[model samples]
Target: MEPLPAAVTAILLDIEGTTTPITFVKDILFPYIQDNVEEYLQKHWHEEECQDDVRQLKLQAEKDSGQKGFVPIPSNTEAELQVIKGVAANVLWQMSLDRKTTALKQLQGHMWRSAYASGKVKGEVYDDVVPALKKWKGAGMKLYIFSSGSVEAQKLLFGYSIEGDLLELFHGHFDTTVGSKVESDSYRRIADKIGCSTENILFLTDIIKEAEAAREAGVHVAIAVRPGNAALTDEEKSEYHLITSFDQLPLQSTH
Candidate 1:
């Protein structure tokens, strides 16, 4: 492994296919939502928080529909039922397409909280992640997470991980609420939020497009290749540092 770049003082990590197995998300978390969303919504629909979620999803759905008139969600049982079914369908559709809209992510996070608390789901991280995180923290390197998952969901995951609570390792979390990961401006915003120069933050992920976006934002970038991650093209391999394990990442001693 090469020496840690001299300028890097902070590390930004992506969750899926980077620290956690993609299967945990695609097979477990997502399927749990698909199987349980309607029931969960039905059980909680009258509550203020659930109602708020429904309202937000309806607004997003209406915006996406591009229709002229208002799509009213009435208070009556029959009307509420109709609206809830429509919102559930839309949420399922969005999940199927893997859309990263804030409302959807928020609602998914809400649902996942219950699943995680009930011990129905637990987060998975690569074997190398814990040791690497400890080493980096010990060496005075700040660590953060940037993922499409809502900050709440991110907390739920690390807070309930198979490795035991690992949320303490992260300095902060960023989600779609900050900006799209594919946009360079998002990386710039993240750097600002972390109070670091963009060039001083090393961003790691399995996605080439995201790596390119961070690079364009003037941040250091690396591509992580893990089991179950999408195969990288030769072009990507040639353009960025490819890391198969967090252990392979070089860290300079701060002591």
Candidate 2:
């Protein structure tokens, strides 16, 4: 906690559950998709991406459910489509049902973009986020975002943030295209893209696997502890640097 330890150069952050509350995404935003999926599909089915994604989801459902000819079962009946609704209940299912990050992002973008447009939602950032970002930027620390959410969705969240356009605070953004955050290769790709050695970059996230992957890539790691998440045991907690608040960060400046 001593003035960010001096070794850190660039900062990579996760969106949901780190800078933003996990409840915002899991409870509010995710449920919005569940509630609107039928209406959304009915209206958007003719769109090429929607058609492609639905077809892919069907295949995924079949694979997951272990049925032959696993392409999405034709939902000629409302009951059949209703069953599909059950399958979509798990977001992890949704991600696995369609391996295409583009499709996942497109759907998320449609949801959040509409939510933002209709005033149904505005993005939230932790109290520590804005001033800390400004402070870090002022201290010449470069910033980037790495999230499972699409980069377009990432932009919208920050762009329409409650703090009013926090997107300007970041130097770059990356998403599942590089591979999921759980994989060490993702951090390596990010490090290469940013043109820096991994040791100089710091990754902050609420998920331990992500921090572990960053650590594997030689980046310094910090775990953000937001409320209502599963508490880590002492052994689990010992593996990484932990931060309970943005102000807890060892920033050099005394704002």
lDDT by residue (tens digit), candidate 2, 1-255: 476656678999998888999888767776677677666666666788667766655555555555332334445455755644543443344543444444455566776787777777788889888998988888888999999888887888888888888877899999998998999989989999999888878899999888888899888898999886658779869877788887678755322
* TM-score per candidate: 0.87, 0.78
For residue 138, model 2's alpha carbon misses the true position, in angstroms, by: 1.5
lDDT of 1 by residue, 1-255 (tens): 677688899999999999999899889998999999888888998899888898788678766665333234433466767767766777887876777777887788888998899888999899999999999999889999999877888899999999999988999999987899999999999999999899889999999889999999999998899988888888878999999999888878656
Q: How displaced is residue 83 in candidate 2, in Å?
A: 14
Name the runs in model 1 displaced over 4 angstroms: 64-87
User: Which ten contiguous residues of candidate 1 have the minimum total lDDT?
Assistant: 67-76
